[model samples]
Target: MSKKLAVVTGATGGIGAEIAKQLAQNGWRCLLVGRNETALETLRKSLGEGHEIIVEDLQDERAMAAIAVRADALGGTALLVNNAGLNQMLPFENTPSSMILNQLCVNLVAPMRLTQALLAQLKRTHGTVVNIGSAFGAIGYPYQSIYCASKFGLRGFTEALSRELDGEVQVKYLAPRATDTKINDMKVRAMNEALGNKMDSPELVANEFMTLLNSSARRRAIGFPEKFFARLNGVFPELVDSAIIKQLKTIKSFLGTKESSL
Candidate 1:
């Protein structure tokens, strides 16, 4: 039989690359999907042989269909990590319509569509679908309006699909606190530092992801205060709103600048 395969989108990013490496080390062949062909080739080489690369932008519908076709042909697809995502840090009022649409498409729609396309293969192998969400998914932040909405949608989709496919496939959501990746720019980093927010490393997130794969838990949010606040916000959102209101000034100070996407 062919080896079990793991298709990981955004495989060129910090967290995504680490996830691919960890999966490869654990004996699961990886199909690294991202828009960067050069970086994908470099990552593929680092992971040794038996792995593959899918160089396509998640914003393209054809990319998702092509990925589904490739995964089906490869067979034994045991895992799909919907890790590709986009974020813009500007204030909602300052955010452009195009950026908002892009974020929603990449962070939410693409994952939903890709998972739907791969459902049959996943069911065949009783595979798992892990959506990489963010702390903002549960606790909305000041400058991340669109990003929060996208991630929140992803979390809801994962919950609904988990129940819908319960016995046939495993659906999980993993929320990581702000990680020290290129995704966060200098202004974003400064804001986090001013707010005393903890920024976890990509390695830490990858390790937590491995733990999630091994556990029976349906959802796991990483970090100390982040995990606490995600649950707290779920139960009492008003309280979270109050807390965020206090940090609004600091968050806005970084806003007026141009947004960056990774």
Candidate 2:
């Protein structure tokens, strides 16, 4: 049998790197995609022979073509993990238009384009598309409107695309809540302290994702209270809204002083 090929974006980051490592260890020939050449090379070496690396900015128009060329060279791609994302916590009014555009390009548009480019190979293998989303995608949060919007769009796109595929391909949305990644150290630490809990490790989330990949599960919401909150928000919007408003006050207090304008 031919070896399964899996492509993972943001493979230099904590979660993405773990996912790539797990996939490679689990008998799949992994393709690591990220902008960090040094990190990508390091990961590739760690993953051993047969693993490949492609360094390209996901926001670049040529990124899809680069991915396609790599896929062709790999013989075919069986799984595509769209895990690259960007987030910033700031008042909406203060957020620059350029930042918003960058967020959209990285978080939403890149995945869409990459998926479209790899559809044929995936269809041939009856492969899967794993979209790494967030809890904020399911519910809105203060100071993260643009980030939430991007995730929500990704979630919606995954749901609709899955239905459209009708089993020709598998689609899964993995939502991990407030992970202890280096991306937002201070903020995450503050939130954890305030909530009296620790942030989930990227490795733990990666393990859950690997399990889901081997199962028939179409969607997974990771984390304890966050998952519960997401479901609650879905069932009772008003209650969820009230709770978030109260939580926002606490978060604001933690942040110290609220800005009148963006």
Candidate 3:
């Protein structure tokens, strides 16, 4: 019996990298996938022998197919972490079509496609699929419209699939709130600070992800007020809308958009 394999996307840096390292530490052989070969290789070496690197962009269908092929060859892939994501904080009016498409592709489409590709193997191994989501997935923020849509779609996909494949395979959604990662630009960081939103380190997210794997829970949303707000928004969105409305001016200031135009 060999070690169970875990295919982790976005293993190059930040939360993804931390998750990969933590998985390796927990005795799982990881298939580190990312566009940066150098970073992936460095991470793979640090993780030691059995782990491998797949240098491919998730946005490219050919690259994704290649990843499925490699995973098939590797055999026992008991876990798939769709952790790769793209985020940008901008007013919807200022957002270009390309940015919207790119965010959707990386955040939602790639995860769906990659998961579909590996469904057969996962079923054979009775594996788990963990989709990394965000607090905004549940409570839509003003400037993060497209990001919220992508994560919301992911949460729905995970929920439906958890029921869809209950006995055969496990499906889980892990939502982390305002994680401190390079994914958040300086402006976004400043906005978070101004809003007094607490940011969790990448290691904290990795640990929470590990806990999710060991537990039987189907979904776990990190943070205190964020998790509370996520549930609140689901039951009473109007209340959340009113609260966000109060902070709308502060949020808008971070958008870097002109006041007159908005």
Candidate with top TM-score is 3
Q: Would you give me the overall lDDT of model 2? A: 0.88
What is the per-residue lDDT of model 1 for residues 173-241, given as tens digits with 9 covering 90 to 100?
A: 999999999889899999899899889999999999999988999999999898989899989989988
Candidate structures ordered by lDDT, highest first: 3, 1, 2
Question: Judged by lDDT against the true structure, how good is candidate 3?
Answer: 0.92
- Provide the TM-score for each candidate, comma-separated: 0.95, 0.95, 0.97
Tell me the TM-score of model 3.
0.97
How much is the lDDT of residue 11 in candidate 2? Answer: 94
The local lDDT score (0 to 100) that residue 250 gets in candidate 1 is: 65
Q: Tens-digit lDDT track for model 3 on 1-262?
A: 3489999999999999999989988899999999999999999999988999999998898877798899989985789999999998988888999999999999999999999989999999999999999998899888899999999999999999999999999999999999998889998888889989999999999999999999999999999999999999999999998888887778778876666533
Error of 3 at 58 (Å): 0.8
- Candidate with better TM-score, 2 vs 3: 3
- The candidate scoring highest on lDDT is 3
Per-prediction RMSD in angstroms? 3.5, 1.9, 1.4
- In the predicted model 3, the residue pairs found to clash are none
TM-score of candidate 1 relative to the true fold: 0.95
